[model samples]
Target: MTATLPRVDTAPAAAVKRRRRSLGWVAVVPLLAFTAVAFGLPAWAVLDGAFTDKGTGAYTTANLTASLQGAYLTALVGSVKLSAVSAALATLLGLPLAQAVVTSRHRALREAVLTASGVLANFGGVPLAFAFVATLGNAGVLTRHLDLTDKGWDLYSFWGLVVVYLYFLIPLMVLTITPALEGLRVQWREAAQNNGATTAQYWLHVALPVLLPTLLGGFVLLFGSAFAAYATAAAIVGSSVPLITLQIADALSGNVLVGQENVALALSLDMVLVAGLVMAVYLPLQRRSARWLA
Candidate 1:
């Protein structure tokens, strides 16, 4: 009770906040710089080159118009169809696999499945193409043994590309949807059962609604992955399949046509636009999923 206490200082709190803010900026600096150097610069270049004449340095829409005509249009359609089919198949196959992994009793089995999925999801490009070729191509070991050619199997065709795509796509979906599957609460199922709801009814009325957003998001991701794929298709089938990515490469290298570098940029821009539209749909679904899962 005795004396005048020294005035408590409040400046320390402000100083701490300032230090934290500085640290936050410091942490983000590298990321910002990397983005500017890598993604931002390249994206800007593509946008610029797409809208400008290379020789005349004049603004034009000719390149974009050219991208939408003839074989380029066919390539776009083929790419979209391929991506859609692969994403759909991967979603259909992966949902069951993810459910099984989530519901498994053994921890080791769950861990192993998840580990394999993580590795396989990233295991694309040349090596993956080569593996498929060795296993299923015309002169492949399995091909010779199984006589798949006579049975109407071709590893260098559109369906064959679909088959190859599913190898990585399914694992990606598994990795993506497993968390959503795990987010399913036991209490929900228990409550449904207690209320005399059949398993089918529970899934149809309750679980599907909860999982729908995440499922769509996963599908969109898989579609984008398939749409942008290049190396694997290039290695496996060359230019046999007229995919948009292959067309873009062709335009860039002046292989199919000269003086079409701007058209290549235009195609790249189209890809970006498509990807943007996909993300626009996916973002809302992702947020909705988080509302339930979180």
Candidate 2:
């Protein structure tokens, strides 16, 4: 027993292990700290502020109730309507574009179109708004050239906002749906055609059933983007037309209804609600996609 194990020591080995653990922590700590400071902290602050007291010492639903009022409700409806219509139109226009991109025999043309979509899709907000304004605004050169003098159109209206939303939404739809279309078996279309099926019949029976999930998913994405838009609408119309983003901006800036924290809380709740609705559409779409593959 006295001579057991030659009196071997594990202390140095344990020390080396401890050093490695410490080095791991050194790497992990920075990322954890950044996440807590940047993302987690602000999200917590905003969410906590939503249920907090405005001026009174008591916490209440006053802000939440205020958000459900007629004006916000109207604005919410308008936002949804515009986003839905624009996304629908964009998808309709984008399907063919995607098909062309995916099936093109010309490598150069396909590459160019994909490049164009990527550029346009990312070019939302101020640049897009300004571009449309230059083409369609009341004092725009294009408008003047078309002999539409004194018959100026407002690009600051609800419909005008829809048009701007479409410019970006179409490209997004194309980028998303093209992959789904490509994944589809080309033989299915050829088989139907060999059977003398019309284009309409082939689409309805063979293509649409498989494509519905992807199309719906694309729609949800488009709707979310449009609903969350602030910059384009803000830059184009300012406060002339009531929009949810402008309202939120005003509240956050404390520029309107001074010191009224309840309004901000209410608007925050409204955004949450809209976001929830958008996510609701997402679940069914995912399920449908699974079913399509099954």
lDDT of 2 by residue, 196-292 (tens): 9998999899988898888888888888888888899988988777777777787778777686565766776677777888889877886777666
TM-score of each: 0.94, 0.82
Name the lDDT value of residue 48 in candidate 1: 95
**Worst 10 contiguous positions by lDDT, candidate 1:** 251-260
- The numbered model that scores best in lDDT is 1
In order of listing, the candidates' clash counts read: 0, 0
Per-model C-alpha lDDT, please? 0.95, 0.80
Clashing pairs in 2: none
Q: What lDDT is reached at residue 246 by model 2?
A: 77
lDDT of 2: 0.80
